[model samples]
Target: MTSQIHVALRPLWLCRACAAPWPCATARLNLLAEYRNSHVALSIYLAGMLYTAVEDLYRLNPQDAPKPTALHDRFLGWTAPRAPRPQPSD
Candidate 1:
């Protein structure tokens, strides 16, 4: 049988593969490999996911909604953009 893909499970945003949070470690690593050539694209994609997650999670439990900063950290913090390497003198 094929293994389940690590995808989000709707409003809950849990990973289908491991039942952890969506974009769990494995998912993040996969995303990095998929978007390795374009950090900007990765950032844009993650930002969109973050927006959707906030909407779904907040609606699911408005009274116990997660903090904005915490959500930002969880959704976008780990993928800090890489800086270009300095050139050596010839």
Candidate 2:
């Protein structure tokens, strides 16, 4: 006797109406994982921006709100774009 394991990929809309548990099961699992990852990334980005904005507001009285230094160093290091080069004098 021989035994084998097989995996199948199915669309979520089809899987939802599937009567067989196995077919729907894997789809649900994958969908859940994808949702979790997206949620985490969204939460991190929102929190980072919110924190930075609040910090900048607190620093506004001193006229320091618009600079990049209000945000976390690590976030700034990762997301901040490079400065443009100075134009040459004619």
Candidate 3:
């Protein structure tokens, strides 16, 4: 288990812990490690957050349209593919 915790900052949706983007490098790494076998759950969780972030940020920056691809890449993308699950011993 990791000793550190990464929290998100509002409006900008940056990392409160590292002050980088929310789910910043450290947060993303930790999330990947923590949810190694639960990729789908992680994706769902991130997607939910991404939606909320979009809504909040959109209200703040109405003039600049947010790109779905870019937002996905930033908030929930960049994760490495999961490793194969361990097989049970006979």
TM-score of each candidate structure, all chains considered together = 0.84, 0.27, 0.76
Instruction: Find the candidate with the highest TM-score and give its number.
Output: 1
lDDT tens string, model 2, 1-90?
Answer: 653222222221122334442224554344345556575564465356546554555555446443445334423333334698899999
Q: lDDT values of the candidates?
A: 0.90, 0.42, 0.82
Whole-model alpha-carbon lDDT for candidate 3: 0.82
Q: Write the per-residue lDDT of candidate 1 for residues 39-60, one digit (tens) a residue.
A: 8999999999999999999999
Clashing pairs in 3: none
After superposition, which runs of candidate 1 have C-alpha atoms over 4 Å from their true positions?
81-90
The CA lDDT at 89 in model 1 is 88
Sort by TM-score, best first: what order?
Answer: 1, 3, 2
Candidate 1 whole-model C-alpha lDDT, 0 to 1: 0.90
Cα RMSD for candidates in order: 6.1, 18.1, 8.6
Segments of candidate 2 deviating more than 4 angstroms: 1-37, 61-90
Range of the 10 consecutive residues with the lowest summed lDDT in candidate 3: 74-83
**What C-alpha lDDT, on a 0 to 100 scale, does residue 9 get in candidate 3?**
85
